[model samples]
Target: MKKNKDIEVRIEETKKTISGSTYDVTELYIGKKKIGEVLAYGPKEFQSFMDNEELGASKSLDLAIESIIRQWNLHE
Candidate 1:
């Protein structure tokens, strides 16, 4: 089994043209496969992730990564 660090997630914050506002994701990854992730974000920005579509999709990747890691452990 791989430790949490073995997993990875990537995220890109959405930018607002009007107010120059932006938000970051707490976690992000490819479809059903996590390579790495950022676990922390600014207060208001972190909340935005909960309502962001990108974040939702990334969550699936995270799940897949976890599953893969668990399966690897069983083999070990």
Candidate 2:
């Protein structure tokens, strides 16, 4: 699970409210930039997205990071 050192990963727990119901959302960030979000409860736990583009989903964060690296073509 090697990643570029310059690329930072952060997961934040957030609360979203809709129709008087509140739910938790996990947001993915690279450095200070936001990449995408995933629901805490879902079939695809590590789904990634950016600017409305789906970066595919994986069962682990390592796989998700790999997808992001390929998508952005970041140097490892």
lDDT of each: 0.36, 0.65
lDDT per residue as tens, model 2, 1-76? 8775565678788877757876666677777877666543344476666556877777875566567656655432
- Candidate 2 stretches with Cα past 4 Å from truth are 1-6, 41-48, 53-76
Error of 2 at 21 (Å): 3.0
Off by over 4 Å in 1: 1-59
lDDT of 2 at 25: 62
> Highest lDDT among the candidates is held by which one?
2
Error of 2 at 46 (Å): 7.1
Q: Which TM-score value belongs to model 2? A: 0.49
Which tens-of-lDDT digit does each residue in 12-73 have in candidate 1? 43333324644332334444643333222333222212212223222343453354334434
Worst 10 contiguous positions by lDDT, candidate 2: 35-44
Count: clashes, candidate 2: 0
- On a 0 to 100 scale, what is the lDDT of residue 37 in model 2? 65
